[model samples]
Target: MTPPVYTTGQVVVNSGSPISFTATDASGGNRTAVFTGLTLNAGPNTIRVRGSSNSSNTTPFFQNYITVARASSTSVVSGTTTTPPTQTTISSPYTNSAVLAGGFAEGSLSDLLAMAPFVPSTNQFGSWAYGNSAKTVTNDTITIGWHKGLGGSLTILKDGSGPNLINNNASITTTYQGQTRRENGRQSDWAGYGTPFGYNQNGGGDPYTAYSPILNAQQRDSGIGYNWVAGGSISQDTSRILHYETRTINWDGGLRQVTYFKTQPMQWELRGVVDSTYRHVFYWLKGREVKVMFIIQTFRTDGQQKFRGRLQEGPFMYITAPHYRYFVYTGTNPTGETGTTGLTQINLSSPCEGAGTAGCPNQNDTGNWTSTGNWIGALDESNNGVFIVTPYNSNFVGKQFQSRSGDENSNASAYITAGPHLQNIDLPGTNFLASASYYVGSLTSFRTWYNSAGIVKMPFSFSFTPGKTNGWWSENVSGKLNSDNRYEINIGGNGGQGRFYSPEGSWMANTIDTIYVRGRFYGASSMTMNLQWKRPGETEIQIAQFNNKTFTVQGDGVERTYAVRMNGVTNWSGMIAFVKLTNPYPYGSFTGNEKFIPTYIGKTNPN
Candidate 1:
């Protein structure tokens, strides 16, 4: 601080101080003038300000809140107050609730949303549709959605603010993309009128409407074919495969359609959608080495007709080619349900060894499980939680894993494991038919199985409790994914035990210390369970624990999905999965083959 009245604007030099200096002002170039006095060394001194405005460009003054800006950059450097960063937020155009509450508020929101509208999009490749012009999950991410059709015609499409849609029938998916265009390899050519002496390649006399001109009632050899390794888009769409096509035309029918026409069996393509979204069934691949295969069903959404001035060959069903990808559910209950934690379905009725002709996965159990055995489904998740299943195993303890062609894609499989509680005991153990009720998806959330009446032992239960938090038998076994790509739960037989209780007659509620059980499981893994379950299907592994406790659980069927990818490359073949265990630190668990690496892969181009 200085000792004199200093003014930063134009002022007469009547400065009073021990050492004074007069700063001139032009009011044009040097508007504000400064009068300094007693300017000794760099020491704190008292200074007074004269209220005045800097009349010249040379002088500048600031009052109240100050905002300092970078000298070189256009961004603000510092400000007197804090303001949150400006970000682009993604929100639905109109909340369903808001729309329901229509009023002035709705009118305002509608006006704001007027800038955006719902647009059709497609992803024959990915699972998520293009963002809705009126909605977006993120700049790149989208809420999974589907476009349904009237009656049975479904043309899968996505919608977003920017209005983007694509189909994967064209390129090399997400691979070989160095210099390739997304639209390069997606076109189809059906030889018809005007080509080759006005002859029709279609076996059907006249290109019919209800019938596709490309193929007659009977599937015959084709003159046109296309093949390529599936990737990002292919793998992502594993959960859903959509096929729909109309004309991309405007006011006057702007024409721009691709066509392929050659004599020798040649390959053609159409359009391309974005990459796919891959996920594991609550628990997907667990085998030492896993491989997935898929197929695409090409059919016409519109009438299959051929004429000089008509649309032909369109809306092909881009499916997962055989040998697609597999997701593996590997996490335990990230939630609180111990029973639901790492809960997976174990084939009780049949081991994953002899898949059905329609492609039902063989049971993966290590024991002698056959067509008669049942799936050891578990839902030991302490706090109740929901787990996903496939081809819902109706109480019919007979049918094995069925191909989800009706409700799920046939190219994928899932692996789930729950309840590390049940363990092995002696050959002679507690024998009872005590089963717990579990909730089923889409159906009854709870299903119960009672013991066969007329047993010798009285209804008196002895839930033998082991002092350990986690049980035994299952402890050292280290549940693992067998080569067959199924869970191997090892349990011994003998005088088994459980939390001895007398719930009905003489009871020991949460007693018997820690119950040693061989109960069933329908446990669910976390989202990290790298499984590739078809988006829409259900399966169950109803396991009967030795101690009369059968944990029968099921995953409800979700929407079906379709996708295909090449294993070893971007998910189709060369993939790395684990024999993951989900029991907390010690209690007891199986670590699955501790010394095995994924070595076996399905052979592509199989002879």
Candidate 2:
């Protein structure tokens, strides 16, 4: 039996040592005592061993014991014990602290979104191939569309009419809207709007022979005009006009495309077909993150291997990174208000505007909006909400891209710029990838989730909910980073109770009641439990009463509500209730010493 070299528990003696023991090993070998002196705690006669350790640091070798009075003799024996009224363990479905309940909520929502930096502007150019000549024309009218999940089907008409098809049906006129046709030297011809290449608008049994033309895919916003430029030739053989149409079907509660067609007719045929109409709009989901990806081949037609275009010339997805409901907390601009330039690391900031603030800054500087980095963030001035973002793919080098409000970049829209773009492609047939992720929540919660997930460096708080281990234990215990990213916790621990004070013996006080804790806890466990009122040079008090109950979480990853009220105790360290778990294995494993994580402690219930 190896002797225990270390001990964990609160101890204070008026005269003699509180703990006196012999150190030994399994092989009958004696080990030197390196144990430090302990400062005895006052008032509490009940003493429970929190943890114990051997020199070898073997698992399952530690145990918890209690100092119970023995009526038979003056000496007392160490044994298992239970001390407490009742402790109810609440199970939460929220796997990450960064996840929010309803994301964000408005006071009275008419056309309200619970979260902000709402869905991005349409990506009308996502699924289609890029080409020099536009090929998506409906009856000579240019059209583009994408399937929206649960929202509705979206089809835009480029002939200047807004989206013609929405919610799987036509909301606007389907008739062909007229658009100007630019000619080089040849006379223009006008033909009635026709259906797509193989469709017969007159309900005829015979349809035109099906054919497709090879179109050069061009970047959508790569400084190119949405019109056909004259090549200075009037000859029919020298001019080529492309047409496009979409065929769709009802799929999985959403619209799915059966096929998209692009066709060009010989100019000399003069069969009388109108120039293609134009539409530009993309798909977006409400209160959800946006992701866009497409494969781009660098080689041009006629077998040009290397891309001869400018390094900055490429079709990139345009999006807004809104800070409408959030404010920059950490990693902000030189002014410390909102992030005006692209950054590699940023915190969502604070002020998660539940509904919204009157005048919030939600734009970025146009000049450095497309800055390159791995992370970015925005703030919600309305309620101190934060919006953190990260690029999930390597090919996507742009992470902090955003749009400026009231600037020429966003056309004066209050949209923040965000999304993947093909900025520097000089290689041939190189596959460019774009991907990103986002988290919206309060500043403290965002930090906890971000640090625990090991995504990026930013302000972070520790989370102690039970469930699968998230690997944040090291940083949480070490206190490497802080909530404001301004200071750090340099004090080390015995790997047991959480240290709230700095190494200089300064305590950080938390006043929020109805706190939520998630971590492994056993019987007879005691720690400072205070909701408010922490005075200088005062020992924190423990909960006097505990309540046990069961609850069902509404949605996975959504915050729930819980109330902690003192049942039958007087001034028990300002504690309301004690929640404990019998089997802590479900949430995570513990070595009998690590402190519990107070996942969240607040006065307001997020639910």
Top candidate, metric lDDT: 2
203-254 in candidate 1: lDDT tens per residue? 4343222111222211122222111112211221111122222222221122
Per-residue alpha-carbon lDDT of candidate 2 for residues 111-152, written as tens digits (9 for 90 to 100): 121122222233332333321123232322223332211011
Q: Which ten residues in a row have the lowest lDDT in candidate 1?
A: 275-284
**For candidate 2, what is the lDDT?**
0.24
lDDT of 1 at 272: 17
Could you tell me the C-alpha RMSD of candidate 1 in Å?
Answer: 32.5
